[model samples]
Target: MSSSTPNKVPSSPPASPFKLALCQTPVTLDKEENIAVARDYLMRAAAAGASLAVLPECFNCPYDTACFREYAEELPAVGFKPTEDHSSPSLKMLRQTAQETKMFIVGGSVPEIANDGNIYNSSLSVSPDGTVVAKHRKAHLFDIDVPGGIRFKESDVLSPGGSATAFFAPEIDCTVGVGICYDVRFPELAMLQARELGAKVLVFPGAFNMTTGPAHWELLLRGRALDNQVFVAACSPSRSEGGDGYTAWGHSMVVDPWGTVLASADEKPALVVTTIDLGRLDTVRKSIPTSQQRREDIYRLQSVP
Candidate 1:
């Protein structure tokens, strides 16, 4: 897909059919530099005519346990009010960039300092007006100890978020669900968004290491897309060589409602732009009718309050 200038004028009612961009960019040790790179990519995505752009998890800082505290900053209060100190560079830049580019931006997961002094892995969805439309903290902490394999625990430093998050995007005229890295492992989150909230797309800004990425990244994405019949988009950081810290499995991709990979990026820094056709979503759902076929009488999934 080609990049095009963003539409400046807002439609009284959002138009149907829009492009989505998955920015699989490289992360660096430098926080400010990472923010700059994210801004540049957003510009490129907007130029590509993407009505919405998504960043990978922890785009502004190194994804390490020790680095979380060092890089963590106070995010805007839950109501989208700016923090008094305005300490979070990532949040500030994201709001500004969304407004300037006039595009809905899924600001990827960041290490956020909550009011209670606990740190959380949080993501924010910003509107073209720069207002925060949705906020989600990672509900599932990535804590696994595979013997002879990678064992890292986010619960040691981060707090799990409480509720499922899905927000309506006026530009795309669809609801989008937000999730972090480990949250993708839980199908209930995506299910709730699709079944209850009527989300057409579930966006997960994840960072899967070499160990799990190759094994489960694509599998989980396809499963979610197929199960819910909703578009699934996962954005990951560009894979880097051996470093002192974690090595992400890059391969950012977008899967259509039919569980097909519409576009994918290799283990390199790049912008993946794809047009998400809602018409196709309807066609698939109508043909399959899985939503109607579900035997809710036999078994029902409950939601957490």
Candidate 2:
């Protein structure tokens, strides 16, 4: 792997000093087509020496709320076999592909049908050996009424995830935090990953709309990185079609501990790959001591209402 020079373009330098890939692509209503695209991107990312690859939220189905009920699926059993045209092909294939690639895979977030029959926006992190190492249900669902008259009431059809989840990826030599699309807007979740779970890198597979993506996507990502002093990777869908003209802002990105945009893909169907220097995390943390400098004692002194 070649060393990544600062602010350069179109060059595959070494394995990012520490490397990860964000698979940013557009999805239509076709689940099989999305699976095929996901498989191809995983191949591309693995070939590029990325130890981890992240896809967008609800990659297997359209981002519309109505689609969840029809598209949601049960978690596959151990050694569960899926038919060629399985209704939920991406989840099955993702587990299989991670083992096949021998790389840690963050399978983004998908709409899953829980045993209770409630649909959930879930994210899965698989080990190289095909084990489901970590799973995060999106704690914060996207329930908003945009100014454009577009509305998304995730609770209408999907149940919210109750806890934060992170997993250790031996490839990166640290615990990795996980989040979904709307979760990026909540800093406490990121803090739970970094402060509570001691995650060195935080991954959020998002599909923010043009309404909020431009304004909050990068800002939320950089703020998490800067405040937490950890690497942040934001993956987004390239398109959306539902709920009164919703459009996704598709600039998937990787930010370093210093909040620098190491690599970012344009608003199109593409992949953003970058290296994270593990050493840089230590250096930044040592210099700023932001994580260590927090005064919980002082905050506790605030008068209780």
The TM-score obtained by model 2 is 0.87
Provide the overall lDDT of each model, using Cα atoms, as 2-decimal numbers: 0.85, 0.77
lDDT of 1 by residue, 153-240 (tens): 9988988888888777766777788889899999988888788766788999999998999899999999999999999999999987
The residue pairs that clash in candidate 2, if any, are 1-14, 2-13, 2-14, 16-275, 18-276
Q: Give the range of the ten consecutive residues with the poorest summed lDDT in model 1.
A: 1-10
Candidate 2, 1-305: lDDT as tens digits: 00101111122232235569999877877888887888788888888888888988878777888788887777653233323224456666786788778877888878889888988988777777776677778888889997874577899988987776777665557678888988888787787777666677899998888778888889989998997889999898786445454578899998989999889987888877888786788789898986677788775222111
Candidate 1: which stretches are off by over 4 Å? 1-15, 78-85
- What lDDT does model 2 reach? 0.77
In model 1, which residue pairs have backbone atoms overlapping below 3 Å?
3-47, 3-48, 4-47, 4-48, 4-49
Winner by lDDT: 1
